[model samples]
Target chain A: MGYISLDQARTIIAAALAHGGQLGLKPLSVAVLDSGSHLIAFERQDGSSTLRAQIATGKAAGALALGLSSRRIGEMAAERPSFVASLGTIAPAGLIPAAGGVIVVDEAGRAIGAVGVTGDTSDNDELCALAGIAAAKLKAQNA
Target chain B: MGYISLDQARTIIAAALAHGGQLGLKPLSVAVLDSGSHLIAFERQDGSSTLRAQIATGKAAGALALGLSSRRIGEMAAERPSFVASLGTIAPAGLIPAAGGVIVVDEAGRAIGAVGVTGDTSDNDELCALAGIAAAKLKAQNA
Candidate 1:
């Protein structure tokens, strides 16, 4: 029963976009996914490429599925490209082992959801998502 | 600027499951897709088969891509099996020419989104989807 609310999702998205703008990043697409890796809400800022949404969703799905930040997934993929490629076959939406996917944890340290961003460099996208979660007074567990 | 909200998608899924329960149908999986055929929300009820989600998504994707109910697509598939089969190659998520997909139209007669249900017979699936859309006070444009 503990899940991200629509208002919370909206706040995360708005703050993510605002943070991206503050960093002078390109237009971003953000996706909020519940613990089940189901999309709760998504938004694409004006000027963002249409493919951004899919990238954002894939990042979030990969993070949630593995309970790790996509940045970490990227590192793992680097160590074993073939294995990571195989993971894509089983993962829905195809896992993107890239930065920008961060888990949204509740006060109890439970991962309630995740926020993924696409636009700028992977590090910058992760920065924006973390800033958004912090702005909402929530915990971002993808260190 | 109008689009299907997460709240509306949630309401539709809840009502769809409730309708299925009332009708004593089998376990169901429902998928809601935005007008662009992107997944907005999804739920697979307990006891539903693992394939239900994919089937539901394919059905909704087929309906949205064609701007018609999946039943109509099924009819077309029946008449021109080869052509319809070829369509699956290009269709995103692979089209399922079944009877359970229904488009959700707005008051302005624009297709806002779609709901697809799978579990019982395709007829029962379509019935549950339509009931859910009706409960949301939305239009189901499936003749």
Candidate 2:
């Protein structure tokens, strides 16, 4: 299975944090996970809340667990709250049905990893996550 | 980051139990955790509930996870029940929004550890936690 390297994970976190900074967003937290949903790297800005670590990890790991971006998971949640809530109970990392979690894919469109970001509006968080993936020259699953 | 030592953890647990005894409170449980929310030491007095161990750890670990005392979390839960409930799903050690959880801080105001107490009322549980921290000559967060 395709996997994310530690170096790539670090690069994603750095770029994500930088993007959030340039946008004047709140202190952010980022987490990167390999295809198997194991954390490769994580960082939370100094002023970020304590739960940022788990939230970030949940976003990315949740995306991978369901084979969809968290944005889509969020939509699914809106349509089927009970189903989604049940999934959260079974998902080891817990599923966060929100935006800002994006799967990274290789040239062949095979998922390699995921990145999750939090600290601002969900839209802004997703923007930073995408920026990080782009800066690393990685392809987002559907982009 | 500052962390709690085994000796200090033991001290905190012992003192908390003693305080509970002196106050004529019900059989109590105490837990001490390092900065990373890892358990350092734990104890349960005779006749304590079967779930006292998990409850004690949940209080302390939840405080560390949210960067706030469990009392504050309880307040937040009152105001934002759904938000706090979602967090509990993602939190690894579980988040219990009740009293008896206190974060230990260093002179610089950095979190070093946490103490949790449980048995009688939440108020009484918190009192013993404070007493334990005092006995250990450690500072409680915001104190």
Candidate 3:
């Protein structure tokens, strides 16, 4: 299992926040998980609505579980709404097929976890996740 | 505002983990949310899936937003599938209204924040959350 420490989570969050601040974006909610898709840490900025973190984590988990990016899931869902609906029935709440989540791959290119961001455009969310993964020296591991 | 700082969130997670260990539960995923429903922190045991935290937080946020437990939402959903479906459509993902979440109430009985736990039965999740709140000395902030 890819060991994920809280410190690393903090680093990823720090990077995301810095980037968001640079862009003058809205407050963001981020979720970071270990290689096994277990939570390492999370943070939500002030003024962000309660839904932000849930959405972020959902995107991240969807990537981790699917071994792909949530953006891919979004594309797939767009093509098959009914199937995605069934998936919602089976999956936990907040399983969005959005573009803000990407799987994290270790140095060996093995996916260990994922990072997700919310409270901005889907493109921005995905960008933040990718940047955090890169800062950690991990691959995108996106599908 | 039920100010649930990251430090408090960490405390809640530790309390939840210790109790879960004592109870011989599988690894748990815990979520702590502020009054605004934004996530303050989360932790998932090594073996837990990424979905746990998202599930737990949604359960807790649903409770806070509606001022009712997820259990109550389960019953309500059965009677109003359309309402629930629209909820899913209109709200970000993770809007499941289910059991296993408790509102953090202050001395004035105001709901300030909430803690949600998963990777266990709903009863166990609720117990762990209540224990966390107690350990944090954050008695139900708003009743």
Candidate 4:
């Protein structure tokens, strides 16, 4: 299985931040994680809230843990809140049922990594993640 | 059960790191925990992954929780995946189900504490834990 390199992680973060800036969104936080949900890189912009780091990492890690994007996880949470809540307790990085998390896929559609962005509307955050992935020339699974 | 002192915990960490260096392994993180599974000391080398600290602690804490080495827990996970996964939800530190966690024993063969190392291969990590325990003049439960 492929993994997200530190270089690609940095590029994702930079592009995500740039996209958020262009949209005039609130201070953003971005996290990139490998397939195992281990953090490769993370950055929270100035004035971002204290919990941004956890929230960002949680989004990406949660997506990887469940083999679904965080947006899909949010839908699952809506359908079965208790089941999703139980999983959050078990997940080491915790789970954030939101739209900002997107899985990065390889040529064969196997998950390579994930990216999560926070600090704006969930939809806006997700847009930034997509923009970042596009800038890095990586595929976003089911995007 | 006896507890590991802060001084001894530090010694374990230092010696573990020294051993990793001698072997030219990747950057490592070490955690020393008391009999109660409370952290006594921790150290993550520069350039180690972001989850190193949590993984290290989880290894040692998982050992204490099941009263077996983390290596054995990994075997249990392989044999009974769902059972081990369920326990991970209840475990506060989370169970990693991997090697590198070793339980330290007192003269009477009772558990005193535990040591966990991470960063390189699981076997290499376990070797570092063993080296640390020996350097501290402690005995591993099943070494």
Q: Pick the candidate with the highest DockQ.
A: 3
How do the residues B79-100 of candidate 2 rate in per-residue lDDT, one tens digit apiece?
6554455568987777888999
Candidate 3 per-residue lDDT over residues A66-136, each given as its tens digit: 67789999998999988866775676535688898888776677887788899899998878877777776
- What TM-score does each of the candidates earn? 0.64, 0.74, 0.62, 0.60
How do the residues A42-107 of candidate 1 rate in per-residue lDDT, one tens digit apiece? 666644554676789889888888888989999999999999889878997668899999988877
Classify candidate 4 by CAPRI docking class: incorrect
Candidate 1 residue lDDT tens string, B81-105: 9999999999977689989999988
> Chain A TM-scores, all candidates?
0.95, 0.96, 0.91, 0.97
To one decimal place, how large is model 1's interface RMSD in Å? 6.4
DockQ of each: 0.10, 0.27, 0.32, 0.05
- For candidate 2, the docking band is acceptable
CA-lDDT, candidates in order = 0.82, 0.85, 0.76, 0.86
TM-score winner, 1 or 3: 1
Ranking by TM-score: 2, 1, 3, 4
Candidate ranking (DockQ, best to worst)? 3, 2, 1, 4
Per prediction, fnat is 0.00, 0.40, 0.53, 0.04
The Cα error of candidate 1 at residue B24, in Å, is 2.0
The CAPRI category of model 3 is: acceptable
Model 2 misplaced regions, further than 4 Å: A1-10, A22-28, A34-54, A67-82, A104-113, A118-127, A134-143, B18-24, B75-92
